[model samples]
Target: MSERNYRAAIIGTGAIAHAHARALQDAAGRVSLVAVADVDAGRAGEFAAGYGRARAYGSAEELLRAEELDFVHLCTPPRLHAPLAVTCLEAGVTALVEKPPTLSLAEFDTLIEAERRTGAYVATVLQHRFGPGAVRLRRLQEAGELGRTLLATCATQWYRDEAYYAVPWRGTWESEGGGPTMGHGIHQFDLLLSVLGPWSEITAVAGRQARSVETEDVSMALVTFENGALAAVVNSVVSPRQTSELRFDCERGTVEVEHLYGYTDDDWTVTPAPGHEDVQALWVKDRSEESSGHASWLAAVLDALDQGQAPPVTTADARRTMEFIAALYASAFTGERVRSGQITADSPFAQRMDGTGARWRNA
Candidate 1:
């Protein structure tokens, strides 16, 4: 690890920014939060004051011009993610963007191009992948200890009242992206992909359901991975019995985690097949205690920077998750199974999650 300390800043002082602030605090000696920016200058000032010595700026442009930073955490709304990340990349600063990294794959591709041009990286914050249990599971799966992943189920079912969508950006296709599938469940399903490897195709359905919003309040999909592992995915913001859960039934055993938002080692349970009880020892061997959240994820990001390598949740990795999302929307709206790499630059879905407007919106 590099001995030199790194300086970072945050753009947008929202509820999520507090999580980023805590992560920076967790990194105390390694990374410092030097600045913060927001359209609401007062909010920015208050956030900076609460955090530490970070100076406040009225806008991201002002911060980028005035501060020399190693990177910036973008906690802005979904629509601003791509542009802010691109601005950071152009400024030769890495961007650690919150999830649904971009509103669309096309926007994410632009960031990828900017990285190629500027040699600055943009990493998405899919923190679940860094959790101790998730990390251990991936390690085991890669070592072929879990055996072949046969079937999996991933779901993010949480309730959001009508007041939740009252926020200007909350339920819109143009701002927050595609309801729960993009904003909420992406974390769980992204972790699923990290463990299962590349996905091959998706058949899905979405409905406006009960929410009086422009986007679907519920969506479900059948996913096929390249390794022949199948997964059933469900994303919803309308369920009263709230939970985020993922279960993988492997050839050797079953591994599962159930939690809302974040998880720790305790949230995971591993069951070995009748004769494969020995693998249980391997599961607990050398397991990390770190929980899934911004802190652990940021630690990995700093480590990558220390070694002069691109950070975790790289654009390519993020793209897979993003592509799956796009494919879900395509499948849901078009009523057809969508394959991986099927939505090209020419595809409307590439330009926007809803493509040519959602069917419900048209109706």
Candidate 2:
């Protein structure tokens, strides 16, 4: 259990698989990439070749059966995440699943069930929260430098060229689970929810404005937080410059964070309330090196495994983020406000998310 060295496996050999590999390497003495598995033997072999002394498997089942892994990094598409993750946990391997844990609420529930049954620690990779800018923002909030937060807004406008969605499962509801909202927006929303707790209700609309995908390439949502703070989220794959930004309006000041997915500089200002000159003295310049977000989170996963504890981001916590998306879809289609608590196992929308529908036809 010493942090000096630990063994880990990666479940998928896709693009994100390389990111996980880098994270393992980044941890250096603390952890090592022990093995890798992919549905395609060629890809698995290629991945194994890049990392030093890694065993390769043609599939996850084979890898799990043959090797002892301290943790598994799952980089498969959204739909395949649950079953594979459960398999790892049930087999006594810890896991760090990529963003947007699963395709639907039901799948997320199964992940939780598997965790309960096995006591395997499963963490969701919402790496944005690890950014230095975000850390600074949290410190400010904790110190009450921002005062009462009234509203927050996040926008992710990034281009996904035709070739980007050319892959069979790229833009589909069945595999990838919708468009940028689930793919790109999930990261920003993760940070939002991390700072501001669970939302009370959400109303949203999604449409296919540009892409050939069955699901919407553009989506918008209006959220009412449990703390009564208002929020708006917009995600699109049609924009040109690829802008990621967040703005907060608070009683004493305003803070704006720029750069959609990477490290960013947070610009903030303070306006003291009347007769509060002494409080103004607390303000200080906030600046720090941006984080290689996902790498930082993966390091935490390794540390957690070494200590026999749960990572900061857990499967149950991720389920709520998925519920936020499900509730948004329900409200959009029904033309009624949707409460997060209303999306239980017995909810009407629960059965319809079969991971396949007209929404995936174009994708």
Best by lDDT: 1
lDDT of 2 by residue, 197-292 (tens): 779999887777888776778888999998788999998999998887777776776666677557644343445556655434554454554473
Q: In each prediction, how many residue pairs overlap at the backbone (N, C-alpha, C within less than 3 A)?
A: 0, 1
The number of clashing residue pairs in model 2 is 1
Q: What TM-score should be assigned to candidate 2?
A: 0.90
| 219-247: candidate 1 lDDT, tens digit per residue | 99999999999999999999999999999
State in Å the error of residue 165, model 2: 1.6
What are the clashing pairs of model 1?
A: none
Best by TM-score: 1
Candidates in order have lDDT scores of 0.93, 0.78
Model 2, position 149, has a per-residue lDDT of 75
